[model samples]
Target chain A: MKVLKGAYSGLIFLFLYAPIVVLIAFSFNGAKSRGAWGGFSFRWYESLAQNADILHALRNTLIVALLSAVVATIIGTAAALGMHHMRRGLANFMLNVTYLPVLNPDIVTGISLLILYVFIGINLGFSSLLLAHITFNIPYVILSVSPRLKGMNRHIFEAALDLGAGPVRAFFKVIVPEILPGIVNGFLLAVTLSIDDFVISFFTAGPGVSTLSITVYSMARKGIKPEINALSSIMFVVVLLLLLTVNIRAGRDIRRRAQTHVRSHSPRALSSREH
Target chain B: MSELIRLVNCVMAFDDVTVLNSINLTIKDKEFLTLLGPSGCGKTTTLRIIGGFEVPTSGDVFFDNVRINDVPPYRRRVNTVFQRYALFPHLNVFENVAFGLRVAKVPKADIERRVRESLDLVGLRGYDKRASHQLSGGQQQRVAIARAIVNHPQVLLLDEPLGALDLKLRKEMQIELKRIQQQVGITFVYVTHDQEEALTMSDTVVVMNDGVIQQIGTPVDIYNEPKNAFVADFIGESNIVPGVMHRDCEVSFAGRVFRCVDTGFAPDEPVDVVIRPEDVRLSPPEEGQLDGEVLSVTFKGVHYEMMVRARDFTWMIHSTASEPVGARVGLSVRPFDIHIMHRAEKTEAAS
Candidate 1:
């Protein structure tokens, strides 16, 4: 039964990832013909390294991602805290409004943001692209952080107040620390979404402020180039490493907290101690 | 005794439902006053109003002589040890205790000294570095107490602080809480649904029901001399025998006449004569006043709880010796132990 289950899982994995594997494999083809299997070569990778336009797009993408992630984290954390304190009906309505950007079609969101920018007389540039990215990224952060806030014990805040803390002090000392992990997780999620954005960036970015995803689309439309494959491979590796790091850190934190909870609440441990 | 806190004609309503109605109470300084009631009887609501978490719909809350109705919870010179201790999971014992002092911007040395002193007072001095979540429920509750008292607030509000513990832990903590209150000499406004807990720890007990104060007096007064049917039924295990007041000092129940010490009721007024189980004596038929057959007998350690059926009603009697089931027994209650209270509807409504 276990072997059969393992086989079933293996088949599902291949079915899901086989297309990506084929794309990566074809990117390394050294033959002149695109369809035929070819010997491996480092020529595509070398060509990718020399592409100054791609490098510039990559830098712009990184800048936009960092800017949007920071802004989204700040705004989303504050919104989560606000919603946490609000009445249930009002909080739910506001949460739905915040998440409208994520649920709306990308093309519609892109067109609307473009119209908004033009109406506001703000020219498309790195700032406009960053703003557009943040509009979508913030909802994800808020969704992530709000649940963590709800799960936290409200008594902690009351305890802080009882211990003589004013409102502002209690928020920073108790509320913030308890929700830090959720904030970090949300920030990373925003960063990933911002970096991978293409359609929204295509509409919002100016000629010289193109992001890496937009550059990749333009390059792919021109021709099926091996250099694009090399670029994608690198981006995929970076994303994989980032996801692994985040998952490991989050898992460790959860495990540590669970162990601490168990140790403190165990009857044997509580009764054995003289104090 | 001087009043430390007073609520004058306090009325609190949530939306259309009134939770506390025209509450007038004066808590004396250094007194342990308990608001005792069944669940959802406005005891907790009253305590929350005193803690400044809830504003009264139309009334004044006074701390000493100052009107504090508009004060926010953080600004009130009162602290509440919540039913759930609500200790900060991320902070250690010392930091939890020191949080208020730190927020007040006290110096580091002073914060350390006060935190240590508070922890020592709660018998947790050596566990300073232990995380709040790394403690048992009882320990967490003690830490909560230490955290509140460290601020030296004028009044400490405890809202069922020991309700979550096991029986053994609860009894132990009750004694500990009494000792701590005596040592601190701060006004304690405790709210609980547990009648025994209120009776054991309170200097004064306020019995409330359905958003109105039923009675307010010392624990003995509230328990032994309940003023109405509700108060008599709620405070302890009572065999309420519905009867008619024959005269000023006489009541007729179950086709029999008994003399009671209570007076002030008009002739032929419907009343309930409350006899506590422990106060009713069970003996052989010749030595007792009422004769009945034992329906059941439950051994409760030092005493036997016997239920005797007399005429149309059953009465619970506690005795030193066990009475066999189906055995004829006699029940005798002292005239002083027979507390007579008027029917609830006839009493004047509190305004």
Candidate 2:
């Protein structure tokens, strides 16, 4: 049974990654042909950097992801903090309202945001695309932060206030530090969603400007570009490196804490012990 | 002593569910007062009101004769030791204790001096850099006390601060806390569901249930002379029986009239009488006021608690010696042991 389950997971992983693997391999092909064996080379990677259109699209994608993620994180975190102290029924109702965007289909959200932008007669450009990304990214941030807010001890906030710190000062000093891990997780998740989104970006974006996903989708109509594969492969490697660094840091922290607790007692213990 | 804090008919409700109903209480200066009740009995809510964490729906709260109903928590000169301690996990012990001083923009040297003093007062003098999570439960509780007291607030509100500790540690901390309160000479408002904890540390125990105060008195008065059936049952082990007050120093129960040192009830009025388990003396069946067979016996370290059956009712009796099961014995209670109280409404959990 274990072998069967392992085989099932292997098949699922291969099914999910097969196309990406093929793309990465073709990016290194020596000749311009699909399905034919060609010696490996780095020509596509070399050519990708000089391609102004693809580079522009990459820049646009990076800008939208960074800005949208930051704005959405701030608004979502503030909204969660405000809603945390509200009456329970009202807070629950507001939370359910926030969940609607996350539960609704991307196509529906894309269409509605498109309609609203058009109705307002705003010009559809980089601003419109960034707004679209920000609009959809907020719900994910709220979902990530709400659990941390729920687990927090609200009395600490009151304790801070009671200790002569005003409201804003208390929030930054006490509340922020407690919920920081959740906030960072929410920001990262928002950035990931914003970077991969294409539907809303397509509907809202104007001509002459494109994000990485939009550029890739447009390239697919004629034929898949090996240069596009090269860029994605680069992105994939960067993400993997980031993950490795984060894991190593977290593991070292845990080990250090364990050593401190198990190996050495605080000075108070030794000082207070009787002969 | 003067009044340090007063709640004048404070009423609090969320939606239609009332949590505190018209509570009027005064906490005197330098006195240890405890709000004692079961979970959801509004004891914690009362503490929160005093700390200015919650505004009453329609009442006033006075702190040293000044109405503070609109005052926010930051303006109130009171600190609370939360139930969970709620120490900042990011900071070290020294930093946590020094937070209030830093917020008040105190000088660096003054903050250091006061932090050292507070830590010394809690017996954590040399441990400045220890993280909160690294400390034991008792140590963390002490840190919380130090953190609150370092500010020198006029009143310190503790909400079951020792509830998370084990029995041995909790008992030790109870004595430690009482000593600290006396040394600091601050009015301490403590809230706990543990009756024993309240009795040990409080000068005034306010027994509450279902959003209302059942009775308020010293621990001795609360135990020896409970005003209602709920207060009597909630305080300690008791055998409450239905009785009638015939007249002064006279009551009737157990199918016969008995003399009790109680009065001020209408003639032949129905009442409830409370008899503590320790007050019942047992002897041979032929030489006591009532006779009963011992149904069960369990050893309780210092004494043996036995269940005696008589008149279709079971009476719990605590004795230094044990009696064999199924042995019939006569039980006698002194007249002062029979505490008479008027009937109370069914507002608390059943015994």
Candidate 3:
């Protein structure tokens, strides 16, 4: 049974990664042909580095992702905290309202946001794309942060006030620290979502304001280039590293929390001896 | 001690559901006053009002003769050791204790010295670098206390700080808390549902029930002279039964007239008679006033607690001597141990 399970998992991994592996391999091919690998070389990577349009698209992606992630995290965290303190009925209503955007299709959100922006007479460009990303990212940030707020002891806020810190001071000193891990996790998720988004960006971006995903799509019509393959390989590695870091930090946090919980409940004689 | 804080006709309500009704209390300086009651009795609400966390719906709160109803908690000269020890999880012991001082912009050296001193006060010396989560419940409690007291607030509020500890640790912390209160010479407004804890650590015990103060007095006074049946039953194990005040010192209950020390009741007025379990002395059937068969007996470490059926009431009597179940025994209570109070409904009407 164990051998069968291991074989099954190995096959699933291969099935999932086989295409990506082929793409990565072709990124190193010296020949321009799609099928023939003349030998491993860095020619595609060198070409990708020299592509100013791709570099500009990458810069746009980073800027939008970073800016939208930060803005969404701030707005979402504040909204979650406000809802957390609301009456149960109102808080539940607010939470369901937050979930609506997340549950709605990305295409629907993109179209609606485009319509709203057009109705408001705003020009479509980097600003429109950023606004759309922020709007979609806020719900993800709220979902990630709501759990941390729920698990938190509400008394810490009152304790801060009792300890001579005003509302803003206490929020920064105690409340923010308590929910910081959640905020960072949400920000990372927002960054990934904003970078990975294509459907929304396509609908929102103007002629000159294109992210990396849109640029890749536009480049696809000109026959797929090995430079695109090299670029994708690097992006995949970066995303994989980002995911690995998030998972490792999350696992460490859970383990540390469990350890502290066990330690807190350990025998008094055992804990006192640590002194 | 001079008066430090007063709640004059304070009425607190949440969404039209009143949690505190016309609460009038005056806390004196250097006094360890405990608000003792069962859950939902408005004791915690009273503490919150005094801590400036909750504003009274329609009343005045005076701090040192100045009305502070509109003051925010951060502006008040008060601190609270929360029920679950709400220590900051991100901060270490030293930083948690120094939080108040830092917010007040105290000198760096003073903050250091004061944090160390407060940690020592809570018996957590040399634990400055320990994370809040690393400490046990007892140690966390100490950190919470240290954090609150480091500010040197004129009044400290503790909302059932030791409710989470085991019995042994709770008892030790109760004594430790009393010693700390005396050492600091600051008013402590403690809240708890445990009557024994209130009696152990408080100079004044305020027994509350149903959003109203049932009785407020010294521990001995509240215990020996409960204002009504609720206070009597809540404070300790009391065998309260209906009776009629025939005159000044005479009351009748359980088909027999008993002499009590309570007076100031109208002739033939209905009252409740309170008898403490330990106050009942057991003797031979022929040598006592009320004879009953022992129904059950259980050894309670220091005493053998027995239930005896006498007339219409089952009397709980605590004695070192064990009475076998189904055995005949007699119960006699001393005149001073028998307390009489106006009936609860009548008292409410009068109030």
**Model 3, range B109-192, lDDT digits (tens) per residue?**
999999999999999999999999888899999999999999999999999888777777888999999999999989999999
lDDT of 1 by residue, B187-261 (tens): 999999889999999999999998999999999998889988788888888888888998877888878888888
Compose the digit string of candidate 1's lDDT tens values, residues A1-275: 99999999999999998977876776777864677877987777877879999989888888888889999999999999999999999999999998888899988989999999999999998889988999999998899788779868777776676666677988898889989988988888888878777889999997778888898999889996878887887777667676776678678767877775575456434444623
Task: Give one digit per residue, the lDDT tens place, for model 3 in A1-275.
Answer: 99999999999999999999999999999999999988999999998888999999999999999999999999999999899889999999999999999889989988998899899998999999999999999998898888888878789999999998989999999988888888888898889888888999999987899998898898987889888899889888877877777677677777877887676556444525533
* Per-model DockQ: 0.44, 0.33, 0.51
Clashing pairs in 3: none
Which pairs clash inside model 1?
A: A163-B100
RMSD of each: 4.0, 5.2, 3.1
Residue A253, model 1: lDDT of: 69
TM-score of chain B of each: 0.96, 0.98, 0.97
**What TM-scores result for chain A when each predicted structure is judged separately against the true chain A?**
0.85, 0.84, 0.92
2 or 3: which has the higher DockQ? 3
Write down the DockQ of candidate 3.
0.51
Model number with the top TM-score: 3
Which ranges of candidate 3 are over 4 A from the true structure? A262-275, B346-351
| Rank ordering of all candidates by DockQ, starting from the highest | 3, 1, 2
